[model samples]
Target chain A: MMQQTSDKKWFDELVVELRLRQVHGSAIGDTVASARELLRDTGQPAEEAFGPARDYAAALEFPAAPGHDWVRQALWPSLLGLLAFLLFNQAVTAWTQQELLLVSPAQLALLATPVVLVALLPLYLDAVVRRLWVGIAIAAICAVAGVLSAVVAPTQPSDAWLAIDPSPWLIGTALVMVVLSVRNTVRSSRAADDDEIIDPLSGTTAGTGAGARILVHVTNWLFPVLALAMLGLALALR
Target chain B: MSTSTPDVRATDGVDWPSDWLRATLGFLALRALSGGPSYGYAIISELERHGFGAIKGGTLYPLLTRYEAAGLLTTEWRAGDGGPGRKYFALTEQGRAELTRLSADWRRFVASSVHYLDPERPEKEISP
Candidate 1:
C-alpha cells in the first residue's frame, strides 16, 4: 500500500518533468503507458525499475515543442489578462463612486510588481515548480504588493501622479478582459481533453473527468470572473 | 589481423568490466534485435539470459529511444497476450549494417588483444 502511494508520487513527478520539457501530450501519454507496462511486467516498483523519475524523464529525450512556445501562447496572454484585471480593479471603485481614478507613482510601481514577476516566470518556472517555498514566496510578494498599492493610491488630484476619468479605463479594460477570456474559452474548448494522458491498450484518457473539464474552463475565464466579483463588491459598497 | 590465432576458450566470464559493457551495449542491443522485433522487458531478459547482468528498464529504454531517434531502430505498439500493449523495437536496415560493422571490428580488436597478451609471448621484447 505504502509502495503504491510512493510510486504514484513518482509517476506524478515524471508527468511534471515531461511537461516541463513541453513534450506533446500524446507522447507524454505513450511514455507513461509504457513505463506502467514495464512496471507491471517486472512487478517492481516504478522507482526501482526506472530510477528517479526526474532523471528518467531527462533520459527519454522525446521531442518537445520549442521552450518558448508556451511563453508566446500562454504567458503573454495571461499577462495581458492580468494587466486588464488590475486596471479594472482600479477603475471599478472610482467609477462606482462617480470619481476620477487616482494613481500615484508608488502605486503604479506596486501594481507592476506581480506583472513583472509573472513576466519573468519562464526563467525561474522550473525552480518554482520544484520548490514549494519559491512559489509561496512569490505569491506572498504579489499579495503584499497588491495591498501596498491600495494603501498608496492617491486620495486627491493634488496628491496624485495621474488622475483621469474612470469611465474610459473601466470600459476599455472590461472589454479587454472579456475579449481575452473569450479567446481562452474558444482555445480550451477546442482542445477539450486532448491533453489528457491516454492508455494505449485501453484507449482511456485521464484528466478528462467532468470536474476537471469544468475547472479548465473556469481557469480560462478566471480574470473576467474575478473582475465581475470586484465590480459587484464595489457597487454594493457604493 | 593476427594470423598467429591460437585455439582459445570460446567464451569468457560473464563479469565484463562496466566500462566495456557501457561502450558496447548499443551494438549488443542492435544484435539482440537481429533475431526479430522485441519489447523492453523481452530485450532486457534476452541480454540477461545471455549473461549481461539484469539491465534496468531505465538503462534500456533510453538506449532504444536514442536508436529510434537515430533511425537505427523503429518501434510499434502491439497488443500483448491479454495484457497491456507493448512497445516493440525492431532494427532498421541501417541498424543491421551497423551491427555487422561493429561485430567485425570488435572481433578483430579482441583477437589482436588476445594475441598480444598471449602468456607465451615474451613481454620484455615488446616493452618500450
Candidate 2:
C-alpha cells in the first residue's frame, strides 16, 4: 500500500515535470508506460529505480512542441474568459440595483490583482506546482484582492473615476463568457485536441471515461456557471 | 562459481565510480542493444550479467530515450503474455556503426592502459 502510494506520487510528479518541460502528450504517455514496464519487471519502487522524477524528466529531454504554443492555445483563452467573468461580476451588481457601475482607481487596481497574477503565472508556475504553499498563497491573494476591490468600490458617482451603464456591460460580458465556453466545448470534443494518456503497445488512450468528459465540460463552462451564480446572488440581495 | 560458465567477471563487489559508468554507459548500452532488440530490464540484466554493476532504470532509460531521439535507435511496443506490453528498443544502422566504432576505441584504450600498468613492462621500471 505504501509503495503504491509513493509510486502514485512519483508518477504525478513525473507528469508535472514533463508538462513543465512542454513535452507533448504522446511522448509523455510513452515514457510513462516504459517506466511502468521496467518497474513491473524488477518489482522496484519507481523512485528507487528512476531517481527523482524531476531529474528523470529532465534527462529524457524529449523534443518539446514550440514553447508559446500553449500560451496561444490555452492561456490567452483563459485570460480572456477570466476578464469576461470579472466584468460580469462587476456589472451584475449594478444591473441588479438599476444603477450605473461605478469604479474608482483603487478598486480597478485591486480588481486587476487576480488578472495580473494569472497573467504572470508562466513565470512562477514551477513554484506553484512544486510547492503547495505557493499555490495556496496565490489563491489567498486573489481572494483577498477580490474582497478588497468590492469594499473599495465607490458608492457615489461623483467619487468614481468611471461611471458606465451596467446593462450593455452586463449583457456583453455574459455573451463573451458563453461564446468562449462554446468554443472551448467544441475544441475539447475534438479527438485531436484531447491529450489523454495512451498505451504505447495497443495505441489506445486512457482516461477518456464519462467522468473525464463531464469534468472537461464543467471546466469549459466554469466562468459562465460562476457568473450565473453571481447573478443569482445579486438578484437575491436586490 | 561454475567452471563451465564463461569467465565473464563481475566487478567483485567493488562499486565502479559513478564517473566511470557515466563516461561509458552510453556506448556500453548501444553495444548491449547490438545483440538484438531489448527492453529496459533486459538491457540492464544483460549489462549486469556481463560483469557491469546493475544499471538502474533511471540511468538506462534516459540514455536509450536520448539515443532514440537521436535516430540511433527505434522502439516498438510488443504485448506481453497475460501482462502489460513492453517497449522494445532496436539499434538503427547508425547505432550499429556507432557501437562498432566505440567498441574498437574502448578496446584499444583498455589495452593501452593495461600495457602502461603492466608490472613486467620496462616502461614501469623507468617511471619517476
Chain A TM-score for each of the predictions: 0.96, 0.97
iRMSD computed for candidate 2 = 0.7
Candidate 1 local lDDT, A1-238, one digit each (tens): 9889988999999999998989877778888888888888898999999999999999999988888889988999999999999999999999999999989999999999999999999999999999999999999999999999999999989999898999999999999988988998888777434455676666767777899879988998899899999999999999
List candidate 2 segments past 4 Å from native: B1-5, B11-14, B123-128
True contacts kept of each: 0.79, 0.94
lDDT of 1 at A43: 89
TM-scores of the candidates are 0.93, 0.95
- Give the per-residue lDDT of model 2 (tens digit) for A41-143: 9999999999999999998878877878888888888999998999889999999999999999999899899999988988999999999999999999999
In DockQ terms, which candidate is top?
Answer: 2
* Residue-wise C-alpha lDDT for candidate 2, range B1-128, written one tens digit per residue: 11123777755454789999998999988978877888889888778877788899999988998898899999999988998889999999999899889989999999999988888899746669
Candidate models: Cα lDDT each: 0.87, 0.89
Overlapping backbone residue pairs in candidate 1 total: 0
- Supply the DockQ value of model 2: 0.84
Docking class of 2: high
